[model samples]
Target: MKTYIHNFIAYKELLKELVQRDIRIKYRRSFLGMLWSVLNPLGMMIIMTLVFSHVFRAGIDNFPVYLMCGQVIFNFFNEATTMAMQSILGNAPLIRKVYLPKYLFPMSKVCSCFVNLLTSCIALALVVVVTRTPLTWKLVLFVFPILYVFLFSLGIGILLSAVVVTFRDLQHLYGVIITGLTYLTPIFYPIEILPGWVKTLVEMNPLTSFVEMFRDAVLYGVVPGMELHIRCIAACVVALVLGIWSFIKQQDTFILKV
Candidate 1:
């Protein structure tokens, strides 16, 4: 791990350049450019508010903020992992040309999306202020869940980057899976609305904890309890371990596949 960290630090400049290139390409030829990051989620929040707020509003006070919280975090993971899945094939030339850490491609993609996620947080902050959601000390610890989501996303990203190099269909299949996950995730609705049996299934999802953690800190204005902290940490550790293992094992042949 120390050697890996040292190698990453040695190539930090290359990683930065890759991340910047990603951000530029994402916004290239667009007039609004990066502003779309903030607006896209805000626009979705407005649509969701108008459509579903009437149904779930009673249970979730500040429904827009609640909705935005789930949307931003889930979208971050989705975008990051999606990009990471394509990172290897997308940069086949770079991989072929020189010696570079193969994992850096996926890591750079995840980091770039993280930057976009941070920009989208402007919309969340606006919603919070506009709705007058209570500001509390718990909000200061909001970084905990964000860190968990990043680690989880990074783990999944590494795993997918390795897998997708060989199984190109995974890219398409993942799109469908992400669509299903969005609805199944209880993003716009509170889990309490579900019956006990169904609620258990939803709660079992690792992403659910991240979304719920966000609600707890930002909307509910309470510190996340030990259960949430433990769950997030466990999820992060498990995913990261699996991701690193998978990536290391498969990356040996990624050049041939890509």
Candidate 2:
């Protein structure tokens, strides 16, 4: 792990080039360009505010703000993982043609997705202001969970990138699986409404804790307590260890196939 960090720091220029290439490819030939990043989440915020807030009539305090907090983070995870699935395969030409660290492919995609996350976060802040949402320092606690989510996504992204390089078919399965998981997650709806058995079962998924943590901090101004923090840390550790170990073991042979 220390060696990987040292090598990444040593090859900062290569990382920069990869990140830049990813950013360019994302918005290439698009009129909206980077604004598209903020627009998707922001637009979904409005739609959720309208559909769930106005139409379905779920009783919650500041439902729009609640929805946006979950929306932004959930979308970030969904987009980052799916996009990074093909990260290595998409860069097969460069990886085969050059000597840059292969891990940079996944890292670069994560950076690009965070670029979008930052934009959506800013837009969400503006919405809070416009909606007269109360501000509190406790909301800052969200940074911890968001950071954990990033680490979680990074590990998962790297692992999936390796798999996708070998099996392109997994890319399609990823989308279907994530869509199903999204429903199981409490993004658009409250978790309390979930049945007892379902609640117990779904809570086993780390994303449940993550989405709940985000809603707690951003919407309710209450940070998740120690138990949730421990769970998040455990998730990140498991993902990192497994993902990095797999990549390191198999990455050398990646060039032969990818």
The pairs that clash in candidate 2 are none
By lDDT, the best candidate is 1
Poorest lDDT segment (10 consecutive residues) of candidate 1: 249-258
In model 1, the runs with Cα more than 4 Å from the true position are: none
Off by over 4 Å in 2: 54-56
Per-prediction CA RMSD (Å): 1.0, 1.6
Candidate 1 lDDT (Cα, 0 to 1): 0.92
The C-alpha TM-scores of every prediction are 0.97, 0.94
Q: Candidate 2's residue-wise lDDT over 1-258, tens digit each?
A: 788899899998887887788889889999999988777877888877877876434567777787888777778888888888788888889888888778888878887887788888888887788888877898888788788888898889889988887787998898898888878777777777779999887889888788778777877787688999999999999988887888888899899988
Quick one: how many clashes does candidate 2 have? 0
Error of 1 at 60 (Å): 1.5
Candidate 2, after superposition: displacement of residue 69 in Å?
1.0
**lDDT per residue, candidate 1, 1-258, as tens digits?**
898899999999999999999999999999999999999999999999999999988898889999999998899999999999999999998788888989999999999999998899898999999889889888877788888999999999999999998889998899899998887798999898998988998898899999999889888888889999999999999999999999989977877877
What is the Cα-based lDDT of residue 87 in candidate 1? Answer: 92
